[model samples]
Target: MKLYRHALSGHSHRAHLFLSLIGQPFELVDVDLAARAHKQPEFLKLNPFGQVPVLVDGDTVITDSNAILVYLSKKHGKTDWLPETPREAANVQRWLSVAAGDIAFGPAAARLVTVFAAPIDAEAAIARAHVVLKRMDDTLADSAWIAGSQPTIADVALYSYTARAPEGFVDLQDYAHVRAWLARIEALPGFVEFQRTPVGLTA
Candidate 1:
């Protein structure tokens, strides 16, 4: 398997992290985002959407960060990371939605502003980050993981951006449960650190 990605992208890190955690040996193909390599014709053949974190497994190609997670979990038959039962699966999917929706526009967008000079509303992004963090904090207070007692793809989906929320000026100080959850994730075997940039609050 080969993952074509940019180092600074949290979306890319999501795929990379899961691959390592699953002990899957894969090559990391760094996409030169600064030179717009992802938008070029060759890379477009892999993913016409011109996105980072495109995974190529033999003849199979997976795009989108969340989709990559699902594909990997299903392909490797990692049922624990992606439950088989209806209710459990739905619960996992729910947080995956949050990771794509709120987490995307909230903390992720905010970080994009600082990390990539993206033209986004930092103030609104920061405010949205807080709202989702509060939701995650409240949910995590009762459950050990975001989806349930055990960690799932739902946890992986939310981990990257939430852990780096502080870099977006979205402080984690008040989200104690969320903080504890981050520590738990870091303690997992084969866990890899997301490359941190000294920006926003971290700067």
Candidate 2:
């Protein structure tokens, strides 16, 4: 399997984290997002959306970070990562929705705007981000993971952006529960740290 990813993208980091946790061996091909490599004809053939974190398994190509998570979990994982029960599957789906919908539009997009200098409505973005963060805090108040008790693809899907929320100026200090959950996820075996863009890349 080949994973086309940008080192600094949170969405790519999620896929990398899951592959690490599952002990899957794969090749990493760096996508130079700054140079617009993702938009090139060769890369566009792999993912028409021109996004990083496209997983190529033989002839199969999967795009969208959450969709990639589902594919990896089902293809490689033997435990509860994908889950077998209906309720467990629904729970996983719910958190994945939060990760894609709220987390992506809120913290993820806000970080892209501030860090990458993308144009965004700063006030509205920050307000939406805070609301999503509060919801995450409440959901994690008495639980260790996002979906239910165990760490699933849902947690992996949401972990990267939420862990780095403060980089976008969304402080985690106010959310003790979320901080605890972050710690739990970080403590997992085979965990790899998300890499921030170097000075040159950000410049």
- Among all candidates shown, the one with the greatest lDDT: 1
lDDT by residue (41-115, candidate 1, tens digit) is 999999999999899999999999999999999999999999999999999999999999999999999999999
Per-residue lDDT tens digits for candidate 2, residues 1-203, read 99999987999999999989889999999999889999999999999999989999999999988999899888875457888789999999998999988898887877777678778775576677889889888988868887888999988998998877766766677889888888898999989888864322133
Backbone clash tally for model 1?
A: 0
State the weakest 10-residue window (summed lDDT) of model 1. Answer: 161-170
The TM-score of candidate 2 is 0.94
Runs in model 2 lying further than 4 Å from the true structure: 197-203
Q: Lowest-scoring 10 consecutive residues by lDDT in candidate 2?
A: 194-203
The C-alpha local distance difference test score for the whole of candidate 2 amounts to 0.85
